[model samples]
Target: MPRKKANETKTYVLDTNILLHEPLAFLSFQEHDVVVPMTVLEELDYIKDSKKDVARDARISIRSMEDVLHDATPEQMTEGVTLAGRGSGITAPSGKFSIFSDLELPEDHHVFTSNENDNRIINAALYLQEQKSPGQVVLVTKDINMRLKAKGAGLAHVEDYRTDQLISDIKYLSKGYHTFEGRFWERVKSVESRAEGRDTVHTIAKNILPEAYINEFILDESGEFAGLVESINEDSLEILDLGVERLMSRHAWGINPKNVPQAMALHALLDPHIDLVILTGPAGSGKTLLALAAALEMVVEKNMYDKIIVTRSTPEIAESIGFLPGTEEEKMAPWLAAITDSLEVLHKNDENVKGSMNYIMEKANIQFKSVNFMRGRSIQNAIVILDESQNLTASQLKTIITRCGEGTKLICSGNLAQIDSNYLSAVTSGLTYLVEKFKNFSGSATLNLDGVVRSRLADFAERHL
Candidate 1:
């Protein structure tokens, strides 16, 4: 085998899951040779015909691979086709791509079953290692078990595909709220306070402030004070008084704030200036309930928007029911059960006012939509609630957010710890991504509800189980 220099090209063997996780992952390895194990291709073929997001990604990966190999001859492909200029808008790199149809396994390798696809892929990587110099062949996978198996097979290098991970650790994710120490109200009132219409705006010294972002919730260390950051500069900071009294008294539809975080969420939800709001917390934390209540209040009572659009991503809970029957709304009812339950709660005490749950739903003008059909449509002057957003990928989040037109307010609520998508983790979830990306934006806010108000049993389970 020929030994390459320190700056020489390296080969990355991609797992099928990596390509499914990111369709364009091949373009990320700049100036490195990429190998597609034939077994990986076989797995992709098996999954390409499904109606799931993974299937769509597999199709896209197949197309990208085809486009890259369009002009390469069979001999050239075997000899490693140059990947330079193959990716759209990507700068050409001195790398190559080839399909590893051959397999080579060590004589003593016995950790993995020979019939398993994962083992076959690992064996392909082992063959590449044998063909290339030591430390030049690396196996890239998102599956932890597969990486462990590769290491057990005596491979030199194995790593997780981290190109799409925005945050490396879950602990560092933004909590959307911060607490200040040392007489917070005294410090805030001492600088400057003025009434801007019904809201009071307060200015604070730059030195006393913690690293705050626009619209981020600011609370006193005692948990009695709450305010929203209006603006900030190097010299000073301005925060709009959240008026805790007003928040506590404010009733959306029929729901009231049950906790401090819920109060902050309601304030952000009803604020006319804020266009985006994200609520993240544990289950039974009143995230979806608060968002729905506020959305109804805005659309029905205040007439701030035309209607309410409710959508969510449905990654199968256990086993998929498969190809639901009926109209769009009917087919989506199972997934929209949460919205329906919230509606029932909102209308529970409104028997005299609305008389029927269907009437109240109609009066609210709520529309249930699936996340799949949201592309290429512009949602204007509507409150779009994306529940269970933790199941969405970053690319899917971008598509949904971009669909928001003028006068549209988007509210995304999800429990990051309850994510169902295998491709998404707490740090890489769409909800977390939005929190990190929109933390500094003036028209956006986030709330992480800590209180679980569902019931004593639910709270106990959340804490213990």
Candidate 2:
């Protein structure tokens, strides 16, 4: 065993799940040494052949390892290989990467007989710590239980890999809307409005507006007189008037907005200029309903889109059903009950619309597709509604959003508080990521609905239980 020098870099032993979450996460560690345990490699080998996104990530990581260690000899691999200048589309890692296959734990060690992959990985980190200094070895994993085990095994360092985490605090995550009260409301009202093309723009002092992103909603304290921040200069802010009355009057397949957030959501959904709309809140907040209603309106009444493409992550439902039998749409039928429920609600509203649900489904040209098969396809002239988006990872969300082609608008709806993915949280959910990233984009809008309009029971449960 050797004592670590003051300038010696830390060694990070990565777990399989970290690489599966982000194949190129090693590049984020800067100059630290990254070690992959042999057990992790074996797990990745088993996973790489699957058709899931994790399998794709495993393959990408393995390929990246090959690209970096292309010319390295067997002896060189045991010692370590430089990962410098090998990263694609990102800054190269400036540290060494090595595979830790040799375990030298004591016979009486508590984890010696554990036989679990996590225990084996933790043993590797322990070996690294015993060979070097206590603080020199760290176990980096996404698994909370594994991290706890590492800490209990006398490991000095353990941390979650945070490469994909854009925001540290969930509260700081923008809701994409701000309300002004008292004198601030008066100042906003005083701002002169001028016609700019099809939009009415108002120029106000930057101090009055403080901080706002492009297309972000600005409402008065009474929830009336809403405007969208169109542009911002150093001293002045330009806001485009959001005609709430017009949005309220507009019906989408016989469904009109019931609240302020719903109205803003409708405005974003109906506006051709807004290519991406994100609706996030608790259950019964009308996220999916508003999105589906808007899709029906745009595709059926306005002929703005050729079809309505609906998809959602079905991890929970898939586990329950195990093996589903049918065509793609039929296989996705159970998971898309939300879509059917919304359609039924819409049908109940308008009896004059011939044939009700049948006519709406036929005339709207709706398609139920799986998110699993959405890769490598261009969705053109469609309103793509991605329901239950909180279940998707950031990478998966990126893949789904990039599938949008010309004349396509994407509506992403999810309740961050109700994330079904085991690996995701309110702060790390793809919905939160999109809301944070696209807030500044002029072509995107985000609406965080507050109240639950479904029923008193649902609202009470949401508040108390």
Candidate 3:
């Protein structure tokens, strides 16, 4: 393959994982040719009717391709068809979208003699590289091994599918709080403090914390100052003073904060003013426990919401769940054991732990729901806890978040390091996307619970493993 010039158009060969990662991935290659190999389509076809969670995505990808090529004849399909873009909101590609029949590729042109699907896809890209000589051909896949194989097989341009990746590195991701070196007040030259009903509001110059956004927490190394960014202006910021002692003393359904991070997470979770609270951290960091405790406090004690809906997505949890024998909640019980374990810990001291757990589960009206069943419904006056959200795609998160109607609050908790999806990384996780996108939203708050309060052993494992 030749190097692609800035003004020249190159052909992009998309692997099945790319389409599954983003159904409209073809349209994402703006103004560039996209070629879908027959083997890729065959893989999609095989996955579409399966019990896997990505089956819907495969079907959507197939429908999108059909919408564009249904009327085109075989000759035009092989040659290429113009992408309409339609209602996709993406700019129509100036180049063409075509399908290639890898099965018909001559054995003489084969890069690998194996009939494996990956080899077939690589062979297709190699064939295109040969046929489109002098024109750059890139294989876009999410599989790192696949890219290595393609490169080793002599394909010049191989890249990861990163069209949806927001940040180049995870270190740049927001931790929801900024800690100053010494005392935060010592560096401040000017400050304006006033009483707002029952709370004190301080107006400080924006340059002090230039990147501060609404509801972002601000702290100092002195361990005495803690404030939340209430509002931001071009020149200044309005910070709501949250005394560190008060923040540490906050509790949710008898669950007290074990550290400053947990305290901040609990404060965000219990805030009725904030509609969306996202929690990210390592395993054993109390992400799920805090979220669940807060949900119970709001739903059962404060009556802030009518019900608590718990949902999480893992490849095993989302697939073949219908075959389980029981009600929806029962079917989800095994997958949502973390939530139940938290419930048990919350009521472990009761006279009858089992009875207390049952009573609280009923009293709170907590419902365990599948992500698949959560779509196409208006969730009103409820608290939705989406656990293990790092495994989800941006589109998948959008589907669930958009379902929240009026009076609904969503608490998304996930460990970016523990993403189970093959196509997702810490940088590409939907949880990361939500945190970055909603950081400035006044009604949303994000927190990274850095401490592992689950156990001392868990903390050691989190650090070493």
Q: Count the backbone clashes (under 3 Å) in each candidate.
A: 0, 0, 0
Residue-level lDDT for 203 in candidate 1: 90
Which clashing pairs does model 3 show?
Answer: none
Off by over 4 Å in 3: 1-7, 84-92
Candidate 1: tens digits of C-alpha lDDT, residues 348-376: 76646445667767887888888887878
Tens digits of per-residue lDDT for model 3 on 93-165?
Answer: 6578999999999989898998999999999999899888888899999998899999999999999888778
Per-candidate Cα lDDT values, in order, are 0.82, 0.82, 0.91
- Which one wins by TM-score: 1 or 2? 2
Candidate ranking (TM-score, best to worst): 3, 2, 1
Give the Å error, residue 74, model 2.
Answer: 2.3
Backbone clashes in model 1, listed as residue pairs: none
- Candidate 2 per-residue lDDT, tens place, 337-439, comes to 9999888777775765446887778888888988888989999989999999998888889999999999899999998888777677888787888898898
